[model samples]
Target chain A: MGGAAPAAGAPLVGANSSGGSLKALDGRVRILATAAFALATVSFSHFGPLLIALGGAMLVARLVELPILKTLRRIIAMDMFIAFMILMLPFTTLGEPLFFVFGFPASRQGLVEAALIGLKANAIVLMAMALLSSFEPVELARAMGRLGVPERLVHLVLFNIRYIDLLYRELHRLRTAMRARAFRANASWHACVSMGYLIGMMLIRALERSERILQAMKCRGFTGRLYLDGEERIQRLDLVFAAAFAAFVGALTLWEILSVAAL
Target chain B: MHIVDGALTLPVIAVGSAITVAGIGLGLRQMPPEKIPAAGVLSATFFCASLVHMSIGPSSVHLIVNGLCGIVLGWAAFPALFVALLLQAIFFGFGGLTVIGVNTANIAVPAVIVYYLCRRGVVRSSPQVAAIWGAVGGALAIALTTGCVALALSFSGDEFIPAAKLVFFAHIPVMAIEAVLTAAAVYLIRRVKPELLDAFSAASPDLQPVLAAAPEASLRSTQS
Candidate 1:
């Protein structure tokens, strides 16, 4: 949760960091970071003997002081239900009986499995945190394009990230206004309904705002395709970074393969 | 409520992806030129709405005003939402690539439902009636979407039912919050930007003129 504050509060870490050395290092470093991310994600999913390794990798990546973990904490806040899922996994899975309380038995295997699952989930989450913290939203959208995501899709994402804050501010103002008007009530469902209507209003405003924004963009020559300033050149450093990250992933994957083959 | 990759079955993801692509194609084909900007704003609004979280009891949930989206954008909301979710997946990784279809469907279906309901005069006719219907409809949409995602996950052989139950229950307070939020938003737009309603009404056949007389009176007063 501590990780989430920086991204949510600052909101421009990725976008504003596009200067000089940071700009130079952006592509290469992001490539390495994303490679680490992919490894971390795949490792988390398997979570057999690889839990400790994935966790270690995540901790090391976090130590790199990237903003990834912070942003991730904010995003993962939406998954509160997963907390209950984690809590139940240890008590429900089938396994050898390890301990008993009253008539219920705790399975050792279940505990171990659940612990691994937790570690894996956290590792994947941390990896995501790191990537988002380091890469600008626009850069990421561009990268997705390079990776074959559709042009219209990329445009939509860029605009969405750009204008999200405006909608939030509008909602906040409206809510404050409502409260000022003494729109208070008891715990009746009607009060709830009132709130829903307010949200609906926010959506309507958002639509109008988007229309204005689009007209603004069109006035400035925004075709369906997004055009970034400056030419994108893949440098020697980028190749080296990509190669090094690939080698690291390849080595770890080989080790995992050998370990499993040996068994 | 965005499902990550490797959480559900491959077949489920494949089917979901196909459906999402088809929906996007359909949405794109039907989008009016003037509405493109509105779609963009809705996309941004969806993105921004997910950021404002309020704690509900032991858990927290963010707002997703798909009902307003449906009412305003009609079928175009699907493509707009797809773009937003895709950004969320890549930029934030909230939802993974594999489940983009499932997540989009989960959110977009409610927007579509709200769109249709608004057309049917379930809302947009009377402020009081709209408020009540909007609240219940918003709650039902969130629940139904969550249920669909859960069912999809369960069919994929993941331990999804219990997780879904927990999610659905936790959402009870949040949904109520969302309901209030939606209703108030509608009421505000009704008061301040009444002409916007006319535009929406013109665009969407379902949203008939509820306060046609009020707008005319306001217009007459301004002219005088």
Candidate 2:
């Protein structure tokens, strides 16, 4: 959000999608925070603590200025899978006797497992939104590259992100062309074959285009390593943010360790 | 099917990431510099494949062409699929950022398996044989992927074993759809440019996939 009087959740449109000043707090720090939060929440075997962790993640997401609804949108997909698990797990888990559902037997441990999975998924997703979504892909790749990730993998990620949208558009246009040709595909084998033709055509187009792009790059003096511009150093504010997150991780880990020990 | 964030427990996540990291390392070592763009394009193709959905028996399912990728790209599918999976998570949130490791392993591991098992058959002169091999790779990829997803779920607790079995069962129709699609594509490619596909990385000459060895031997290739 811009200025002193901006409305709540109204982050300024161009105001660095990277969680603002907090987001600028170094890619390495952000990566660490994401991993630590994920590990801590995912380690929880109990349902009660998982709820607290989810609430804490939501609270942090709010504090760090991530859009809650947008974060929740990601959580929705996880919810579907979790829902499926809960529906199927209860009846099939072998454990101490629990209330019967339908004709199948439901186990207490199964119900707890379902609840933990749901809560852990939500919490981890929320933290990811708060910590990782802010940084752009290129920046994330760069951070990872610096952090000992293979250079080729980073370059692959860069190239993939750069071309992924373009290819998606190409696929859309191809599908449109098929539709224009009055092609109707359903669950039939004929439809599958038609779709296969479509994909084959798409693959040929993509390979040829790649060759062209490679030739163009070579013509313009290309090397195996793509050099990215910008040498922005981590500033003092970034250190402060990193320190805060580090302390948070320590506290969270300690709490989890104590809770598990008690259990 | 990409497993969303936090769906897996710590042990599964650690093992998955370790395997993925190793596989990508091998893939990079195997891939030559000139072939980078090819891998990138194929990665983008898989990325776009999500946009095109087809109806299978009772429901529609998006294509996860790790099998095809593995057949063509070999171990390189690790990095390619990893990049695709990451972008999917970041842009579409179809999967989660945190769980990219496990999802990548789940998809890419099966692909590499298919590559080793079926890449040879795919590059053959016989269209029917190639199609049969493609069908096997396609069916196998989804089956193994479903198993990986189920295993990841089961890691949360023993209570998930039945649910895991159900996940595998639910994908039986998807396996059929993948088989049909892959077989058709294999047939078409056999008719088209054979050089465009490679069963292994360009670096290796030992098993030089059928494409590299085809022209000199077969005068009659993919006619009609």
Candidate 3:
């Protein structure tokens, strides 16, 4: 399983990965391009187009200068979640028998469907990470704010980003304290009850911290209105990138339509 | 249980998206602006808590704790859970952009149901009783979430039936773990800071006087 714990403490505002030309594009443009890529990737079920989409995603990942091994590892970790589904589809779906494993026939259609889902999922995730993961979480949330996400929702996201690291540290401190007591977590009633108490303690502390934060904000003249940064005008480079991405997505869509009709 | 992109059919995705949007709208409506800080911090707490892995036999699993979320946040669990899902998708790619709607609906709808079912019991009962109710709510939320996931998969295609069954069965252990954790958490909250669970009632406009009176009594004692 992927380690979500490390990610929880990852620096949200800065990690200095946005070095490539693609990362330099406007956030809105990148967001739209990522969405377009996802939509186009998912619109097809054919193995041929899905392969093309995966290749295109890889190419984009290259353009974004993403760490290749790290990105591939992340994608493989995601695949583990669906591994059973992919494996089971071959035996379950009805179609011409491709082969037999343990006297059960694996259908050709099922194999195709499984491969298509895997490819489509990987393509979308790679392109999304390539295009948008470079931006700091705060930056992405701000872009979404400008993109007409409800102001309140955007504020909530911003606040979450602001506090996640702090809270994560708090959790770490608590866990460290537990470790000092030689507590070993296992599948036992005592372990579970102790873990439960840990969670409960964290939540109580969180609530009290929020109360203090509210008071601190009120002291600073908070009136429930948080001001997001001013928007950036789309640059010429952003327009060019947007138009190029649109053409690529448009071509993918056309290919999908023709392929489906051909079938 | 996080459905990836292109797995679900278009109609399932659309319906999921529509329901999620409506749920968020309702949740936001009930949340006053002054509560934003509280909601935001609590949401972050859940996000962090979900990252905590618990040992179950040979393998470990991270509990979603949606039952606890529902018990604490009420209708606002919708938006709070949505934010967590969104962050997870964007940062970790555990879920996809398009399927986020279905994922949120699967997790948060059960949370809301749990809230309705257990909130009254937790508020009015003793600590032990509230913890038992919390266990029920926690287990019930996971069961329902797994059911929703299976239903979403089945709706997508007959080919997904086995996968759906597998997903549901795989989560049975999770339900038990979450139940224990949620009960303990609720028990602690009920003992140490009952008002946190009473946030929904305290925030209700009509209940302002009662809420105000509770604090004033403490204020008077402090002054004296």
Candidate 4:
């Protein structure tokens, strides 16, 4: 765990399959349908619904032919904080004690709750990785814009994505330089101060550059709008795929509801 | 500090989203046409801040610096952080799209609070005073953020109280590291480029935006 690269903190998109372009009919459909399913998964809390959703989400991932294990690892790694908290529940939560781990009581209810969080988080993340990873960030932003999200919000997202990678690379280089200069930053006040100075320099540079970037944009006649060609309509294939995805999610949701009613 | 989907209840989601929308609205209003570029860049800075890991013991953790963002960007931290969260969801699957509202509010709201609580001293003349205030703001921001995260977690039910406690405890070290980092950063900026401390100081009567990176704002921030 200590050896794991700190890159997961920002987590760029290279872990994803870059599966396909969302310009394709299926890509758009996948985005639309998976988004709905993701929301549905969020609203759901039960273990059974979540387990079913996890299977369904995995199936969607398979449909896209995504690299499954890699994406799963990335998901778990990114969510380690939440995972850590959930893992603690088994020891901390009071219920019928099933066993002991390190002399702490592990309970049945706690184990079930932990499983629910794990499955729920994995299902949502898998669906996201499979469907959303198909498009580049710019393409995804455009698709989101076309999907009726506010243009301001869309542009904000696009602009940030536009700069995140370049800035991250700069940060990596700067850190390397610091390390070269014998900046170890190892659990000390001096370490924090060194890192803080580094961040301050980075922020100051970015602040100065913003003015020039704006002027360059103005010179290029970049009005407040980001205009891109080929905002395509939803094709028949997209509709069919969207319908199928909807049906799968709907069926599961209905089953969960009915089962709850029965209970 | 990012929460995944299915981790929050409906009322929590609803209230969190509503407050987030309002915050962004305020942020947009604060960001003038000329300032959007600066906001964009600052947004990117905050976005990338997470990737900058300060080594500790055998491992490392990235800086959240929402407190620093708020100190510098004020309400603009709203759209700044919102964009970052959205891109992370899209590009990296770090957090889910459904939870964007809750996540943004959780991070940015505390940032805005710190802005009110600490931005003045950050731009103050005395570096020690500025650093002290920065440290307070930075450490307090994480505590507040953890509290907000816990609040959102508990909104689903009482079952999440333990998880909330776990989150708060886990972040104590981060909070201290952040305090020192923020204090150091505030002091350095105050020493190196004073204008930047007031570049977005809309509330400060003594200073105005030097959007062009001209030396005049620096002169005034220094003199005043």
Candidate 5:
């Protein structure tokens, strides 16, 4: 179980076992991407035109390097939630009715509103997918640190990402064990209740395992601080990329603000 | 409730993140070295528990065994929960990194509450009682968390409220399923692996009443 790859159905971002290359993008690129995403989110709520533009930008950006199939897989779960939202919009929103489904009136304004919301949601999700796929977890932690995120928070994020998959594998084994025992929850509520008990027992076991790992780390001279190699240095190109990205976002934001003020 | 990215107001996420950090600090400070393995196992349990989905309405929802964690680990449940959630975020994308704090707090708070409640005998004293309490705790935790998450999501955009309501309603049956699973899990441990109860006993001496009350309680509760 220790050396096994992530399970087939598992989420893709943290499944990279070998800890893929750090700095998949130079400092400038990283900064640019971050700024672009930030701007995209902020503008999303206000201007419809900007939202469309950002959506196109994300669509193009995602299409360039990422496999279409992989991107589609990532979006699959999100699509469910988005669909649900679209379905509810016609029922809940107060606006002009466009059509009737059975006895219920479907609002034209609500449908438009829902479509826009879905678009915004997908854009944000795509941006994040791009960021997570391109950047290593450790590098992201460092970037957060450089941006003045608290050290403790960064450390927590790092440890959490690093060990999460190990926990998942452990969970898979436990589920198999439960199934092997013919402990089906459908049998009775009583059986289901016992499943919770098993969960409790598993939690206790996890604590014990984590404790041993921490002790081993301590023994190996792991102080509170995590030290990386010299390769983590920020290059000049990174700075240039970040500057250009920031300028673009600043300009977009300025345009949105001016447009709003005019209205 | 795992609040997805772009579903919550930035302020709520920001504040939630701060609160989550504080909770982590408290959890770390309180957690002893020997207990870390137990936390990891609990995390694994959480992951596994969620995977065993019980089909209800149009969709299936998995159990969240936070109550059992609360019963055993107490405050340590926070960090343990944090680990489980982080993994869920990365592997399943159940929640996003930005909303980690909110999700962690939503689950951890209930676990802690159940722990305190179990000690007070607010739950029954038998293994059956433990099971029932575990179920109630588990179900209530999920419901409450989902509600909170829905509220947070609503603050982000106009469409958020409707989306949140759909999710909240969808989770109702799942919450019941979780309750049943949590109860059965407790009962099995009492019958087969009694040592698992050792952690709970260590955390609170008062649990003896519950252990002693198990046989008669199980009989009465099961008969009823």
Candidate 6:
């Protein structure tokens, strides 16, 4: 488990450095900023404001020293998933024809709509990655609890964080055993059944592990309550971040309002 | 199969958030304090399970296994799956923050539905028969989830209807894969640890004995 590397899609916080101002902010502030940014970005429907939101997200990404090439690659992969919708839009949507693809007319309106969605999706994703991904899962859960999230939900989140890495290592070990058995995945029923049994084994093991964990907690006099780490007061850095973020969002909102009024 | 932010309309996002909050509330109410450790660890297992990629032809797809989650965790699946999605959004950026609510509703609602529909057969029937019900529940959950995704998409706009339809059709293979996996998992649980299923059905105090065994008398004996 200690040797397990981060999954491909799951990027770690500040992989190149241990300390940064962005990582020092309170988890609560980061969560609220990401929420506000996403909401504001999604509310845009036009190209002008949407592109600006994307640019703003890029600025934040740079400020946080995000890996530029990696972030672009991730966003492009996301676009591929939605490419079908974007491609179909020009054909299905009725409006002024931009050009003819084969025998079909591609509408300008559909093109604009696709671009709008692409921009909004990219901006929101970048903003979230920039802000919330910096904090550890436990820290985020603690903040969520402080933010009035239900205690049970917070506990569930913490439990997930504690065990995800352990189980992931278990999965790796099981797969290694499978590899040693000369088993390979292919498009066959035998393979499916093998994988199924593998997962079945995983579930059984996880249940037994949980049983032991519950026993251990009971031994320690755990009484349905967990005392989280020390009280997280709003530090000076947090207040500064909040002010800067508010100003950025305020600028975006002003731009959006101006664009709408002009239209 | 998460729908990223900016794709959904305001109304869809708002309605999805409301429903998800209510669902989590119901799930939390059903879960007692004693179940928290079990629920947490099981949900963590599910989160890890989802990271496993299965090969199909030349492409690979990760497992969504919400059906198996529903059968095991029942109503608790809502909060469990929601936490998983929230983590994915935060750590992986696979789905955006705003759409987490919608994604949770789309995934977890079907899980709860399958729980209600198949939990009885899963708990009472023979292992072989139970596997069949598990397969049905797995397929039904995915089918319903895709349907929900489609509805959410189309409700957002007429333009999204095509994309929504495609989403459902694209997941047809996933349904079959999940069905096979769920059947086998259910069969194993029934054989290896049938008591796990009994937790939801009976008020059996399985933890009470463990707690009783933890007092200083046994602790001191073990230390010696």
| Candidates in descending DockQ order | 3, 6, 4, 2, 1, 5
lDDT of 6 by residue, A15-117 (tens): 3222145767888898898888888888977677778778888877777777777667767877776788778888878899999999899999988888887
Q: What's the true lDDT of residue B218 in model 3?
A: 34
Model 6 chain B, poorest ten-residue lDDT window?
Answer: B200-209
Highest DockQ: give the candidate number.
Answer: 3
lDDT of 1 by residue, B34-108 (tens): 344666666676666666555544545566766666655566677888877765554454655546788888788
Model 1 chain A worst lDDT window (10 residues): A12-21
Tens digits of lDDT, candidate 4, B73-164: 88878888988887677656687677889999999999999999888777754998999999998998999999999999887767678888
Q: With candidate 1 superimposed using the best TM-score fit, by how many Å does residue A157's alpha carbon deviate from the native?
A: 1.5
Write the candidate numbers in order of decreasing lDDT. Answer: 3, 6, 4, 2, 5, 1
Report the first chain's TM-score for all candidates. 0.76, 0.84, 0.91, 0.86, 0.77, 0.88
Off by over 4 Å in 4: A1-15, A20-23, A26-31, A45-48, A102-104, A228-230, B204-224
Find the number of clashing residue pairs for candidate 2: 0
In the range A148-224, model 5's lDDT, one tens digit per residue, is: 55444455556555555566666557767877887665535656555555565565565566557756765674434
| Model 4 Cα shift for residue B134 (angstroms) | 1.5
Model 5, range B131-201, lDDT digits (tens) per residue?
66666766776777777777677766665676788778877776777667666666666555555555433
* Candidate 3 whole-model C-alpha lDDT, 0 to 1: 0.81
Two-way lDDT contest, 1 vs 2, winner:
2
- For model 1, residues A115-234, the per-residue Cα lDDT tens digits are 654554455554554444445676766766665666555666666666665565566676668668886533345655565555556666766676676567657754454465456667
TM-score of chain A of 5: 0.77
DockQ of 4: 0.44
Candidate 1 segments whose C-alpha is farther than 4 A from its true place: A1-9, A12-40, A43-49, A52-64, A67-81, A100-103, A176-194, A228-230, A259-263, B4-6, B30-34, B53-60, B82-101, B122-133, B173-224
Write one digit per residue (lDDT tens) for candidate 6, span B1-224: 78888788999999999989988876776555666778888888888878877778787777898998888877778899999988876666677678888999998999988887988898899999999999999899999999999999899889888888988998898899889888888898898888776544232223344533343444344435
Model 5 DockQ reads 0.21
Against the true structure, candidate 5 has what lDDT? 0.58
